[model samples]
Target: MLKQNLSPDLTPLRHAHRLATLYSYEILDTQRESVFDDITRMASTICRTPIASITLIDAERQWFKSEIGLGKSQTPISASICAHVVLENDVLVIADTSADRRFGGNPLYTGDPDLKFYAGAPITTADGVTLGTMCVLDTVSRSLTQEQIDMLRMLARQVMMHLELRRMLRLSEKTSDYRARMLASAAHDLRQPLFVASLSVQSLLQEAAPHQLKRLTLANGGLETIKKGFNRMLIAASGHASFTLAELDDTDLGDVLEFIHANFLPLAERKDIRLSVLRTRLHVHSDAVQLETLIGNLVANAVKYTEAGGRVVVGCRRHADHVALHIIDTGIGMASESVNTLFEAFRQGDAQSEGLGLGLWIAKRTAEALGVSVQIHSVPGRGTHFILSLPLKASTEPSSEPIVQVR
Candidate 1:
């Protein structure tokens, strides 16, 4: 087997041609299964070879995805006899390794599990670049019957079909996962508005008294809460819906925080908790829709976990290259285990919280995509704080815009 380094510069056209050929197989680092294994086993039996391998040659190594009677999955490309087999246009056979000068003292023959005989067929895509070799090995020097050689070629064709089918199946699974997420988000959004309207109507039917008026006020507040929940769900679903970046604007961070304050205050008041914003003069280049969703989830979570009469604060600090906004709450903070998975999709620290378990996950992903970063700090019995950091300067030209603060 000749040892030639396949460098890109050595033959640019040839390298591109080979890549195209390998791509046609659509087999890269894919999962293994019984279907392909069965074919290898059958091929080995028919050929009467003690050891057989289905090997794919990568940049640095000859990789066996499935092998019978072999423990190692890889060997350096320089040492592979199959490397020579791939360069050939047809079946490569060594009638007897001991008799042939090319392989008589081959290291593989002198080392453990000695190789005395070799036979292989090239696994070439339709474009004609050999991606790898389908081979059988023997410990005793011997020649294969012509019928056996033909069977090996037929099995290689079946391997190519198996690779193609697996790729299509994986693509289908991804599409199905995407559709299911959309449906779940829709259900989460619709349940809120519908629940609020029902509750408002029921409150109206109660007797007109002091307690009744309080109930009415609480019900109206619940309607507002539902409105905000609907908005955030839309934000999260939109992020999942697209691959391209969305339109951004010079958004007022102060105004965004103020709006979230208005929505969360009533919930905080219901529990007799204090909610206040300590910073108001900051500006950021961001998507207004996603920025709103990010802050809203943090504030809501603070209120949800805090006990009665606890304090929750939202503030922003100015740094050299970035602005950091934090929502700190004296609440029932999560344990380390829960916090680790806090931003994972469909994970919940408290199953009782009003969410589809995607708020923090969406917020984390949306902030990152918009060139912002988020941090979380918490103590189990004390509280939790969410810090959002955004670059002071946009990736584009510096703007002369001033930071605005609303008291």
Candidate 2:
């Protein structure tokens, strides 16, 4: 005997939560794939039904992720028999939709290519959320045999498994791409400084005693650059270190900015660019070392790109609930279009620019780890600004520490 229940019980809150879970899969409105199409086709053939569909119940619509002989991509949820199947979270076998009180008045049942029979197995996640159904429809009233019902249920599980697999595969591919880009950037950036240090030492050896002092100074400068490059590399590499949230401390933002100024000032001077920091008494919740690394990358990048007489400013602005740390640089600013790729590893605004272009990428990852927001604004030939918005640590009071000048 076919189970009969036209109007399935569902609560508004539960349905809304189900919709949220469905959206998280990101499967709605996507293109059809052979994996799902194969399942629907097989379901139709196995059940001896002319029509089969892999339906997804969205907010107000029944979308066909895959269909065989349905001849339609979607229909209103009100007109869908599968919507009831989602609520049941089990196989729904209606021997005759025309006789079933729940679906007899449904337009899909009375219209052309009339649907008289339906057998649906809920496509459910392991977490017990029913996304939709894998259903077979027929024009003539008929019941699915016990064996056929079991097969349909197995096929529904396959469909859900495929959806999960697809999502995992996509995530894996993205992670792999990210790792590749980071490796490429690290290799290129690390090589440049080491190469420069090697060449500086070689040139120093060839200089006469009278010019040895100048050559030695240049060699020392190259070593300093190498050390700075390694520092950036080490900070970026150590980002994956496991740390408990309990270890998070109240960080003085001003002190971190001062350290960035002191460290980058010499590099800025070498380029004949000015590096300045405007002191602020803002306190934020963050790890001091990680915060320093994040700010260091920004300051280094600013000084690296600015012209000889350009200025790079580091300051903080307090908002209602957060503090914005700004790294403003009068450098060769990037085009609006290029800004989108700035945080992508190995991507550079100017292909000829020094380093591997991973500074912003590292900075972005660090911000994410620290639970902060990073914003960027730039204009070509003018300048760029990177703002890191950090949540205020209300428990800590701001300090009246004197501003540290490194210029």
Q: In candidate 2, what residue range of length 10 has the lowest lDDT sum?
A: 176-185
Error of 1 at 93 (Å): 69
User: Model 2 over residues 44-105: C-alpha lDDT tens digits?
Assistant: 98799999999998877889999988788999777878877887677899998877778656
Superposed on all Cα atoms, the candidates' RMSDs to the truth, in angstroms, are 20.3, 20.3
Q: lDDT per residue, candidate 1, 33-142, as tens digits? A: 45556667767887898888888876566788678877777886656777776665478888666666655445676567877888888876555667777889888888
Q: After superposition, how far is residue 48 of candidate 2 from its true place, in Å?
A: 74
lDDT of 1: 0.67
Instruction: Give the poorly placed runs of model 1, Cα more than 4 Å off.
Output: 1-187, 192-245, 394-407
The best candidate in terms of lDDT: 2
Clash number for each model:
1, 0
What lDDT score belongs to each candidate, Candidate 1 first? Answer: 0.67, 0.73
